[model samples]
Target: MDAVADHGGSLGRASALFPQAPLPWIDLSTGINPHSYPLFDLPATAFSRLPEPARERTLAEVAAATYGAPSAANVVSAPGTQILLPRVAAAVKPGRALVLGPTYAEHARACAIAGHTVAEVRDFDALFSADIAIVVNPNNPDGRVARRRDLLELADKMRSKGGLLVVDEAFMEVGPLDERMDGDVGRGGLVVLRSFGKFFGLAGVRLGFAIAAESLAARIHGELGPWAVAGPALEYGIKALGDDAWQQAMRERLAADAARLDALFADSGVEVGGGTSLFRYVKLPDAPALFETLGQQGILIRNFIWDETALRVGLPGSEAEWRRLEQALAAWATRRQERAMEAQP
Candidate 1:
């Protein structure tokens, strides 16, 4: 397997690489929510002055309630989970790190950057052997969810060795509630990372949270310093987190969209691996070729270097985007058939 890219959502890179492909690219390369949360006009102070500590407190309170965290003190807000990954790794002394893999590449990268000897392991039992272990629940690109019981058990084992279990629940909002470990933050060395942007479709807001015991949360908070969250992010995050109705509706919408995407892939003769509502993972020998084909048509989906057969397709926001994707998939099917015919003996 080749080295995986650090992250996705590079529209500029796509445009530069495929300049002649098309204009107004339809990006399905990330798991970010297609239908973003509605925004409203912000108060002048949201930009002119520093964010009020009271507003930041309200944001944490809302986040704690929204994520079912133990308490507001246990929830430390950050600009985004990506920034906190390394911060969390740094807070803990450098030690053996095992990142459950073929998942997000950042966990291992962060750990290694923090000066830990990092290894990507496929087995859950590897958790017992490391000082810090990271698992992306509803695992990225593939959405393989580890059982809550298994996670708790592993956390307990790691705790006995004075280790930490970092569970990245970036997509868990679209998954089952029982699979979440946020409420277990203070128990047996568990830390939960939640992304506000992925579920809310406001990636540019740059907001995320770390739910842990107060001591560890304080360590992360201190490292981040004051004003870790932006003024507008604090304002918007409070509203979005408290809006239970919108969250519920968005969940239903994402579920339907995911099912529709799955059916579309199946109809186009693509074999889908497991996935959550945010994205579907397709495993095909021609994934790289398909990725290029889709890019040529200005349809950008995520392709993996770690596994050449894997492609991650996110939901299209509007009807026109859906039709565009459908047409592109049909074109791919037609081209595949032509290749098959040419190879026939």
Candidate 2:
């Protein structure tokens, strides 16, 4: 297989290599919501490969509306954010870019693929002081969000130096859709990439978009070619965009689910570090052990190998799933306590 296993809780690759286990694992490593927007209502005609003008208009309008784009120039759709990242790197040709540390590794990977020297802003000062910054809003893995004003200031500095500021807003819509840094994109050097995968549960559908000024949008679109999105992706993308009711309900449910995740961690002595409504990043004394324990119980979660001491886990959809995770954590805690007791003087 040509695929890389970089994501949290990707057992499919492993399953392909080895004999599959009996009980299927509940994958929580992905920051995506377990309660997905229903796609059953998508038009039967969506499967056709014909150029869908109405579908295209709906996608463009709905995406633009959701992001509160200052102008139609602000929105460009993609198969998913993954493909768009490479396209943006190709279009912008940014060199000496600084990626926020411990972010989605794919950002750096994309920059590297584009032949850019990707330096990580590791120290606190570099993070606050980088001239060109690619900050992932509600960052991946660790889940920390940068302050808005600080981010704006960074963008301004980058613009002054003729550098670009790219932010991955993939998880931003999980909270307030309006919290997007829309006004800043027109400042000439800023772009925000949003994903339809996480919040809308459209990961398999591969829908994502970018918000940029007209010039930049045109340039990026040119590099990406016309009609980069598939027929099913484009059709569903429009339907997904036009549906505000689903977005509202998802937000409300995720907020509640996030609260429950916090409580579960607090009760079990696992310190959840940061996340808004969609996912939570946590630090446990023994994240690998916890990951194994949870995995054995068929409750798969995200654990960063680079930081073996921390893990990221997503909240489940229903109360039953939540209860299952809660019980698994309780059992894991008891095991830890027993191990500690064994080592006591």
Those runs of model 2 whose alpha carbons end farther than 4 Å from true positions after fitting are 1-4, 13-22, 123-132, 176-179
RMSD of each: 1.9, 2.6
Q: Estimate each model's TM-score.
A: 0.97, 0.91
Per-prediction tally of clashes: 0, 1
Model 1: per-residue Cα lDDT over 186-283, one tens digit each = 88588999999999999999999999989999988998888889999998899999999999999999999999998998898987788889999889
Residue-wise lDDT of candidate 2 within 72-183, one digit each (tens)?
6677777788887766765555566678877788877777777677788765347434434688876776666676677777777767776677888888886444446865
Error of 1 at 26 (Å): 0.5
Local distance difference test, each candidate: 0.89, 0.75
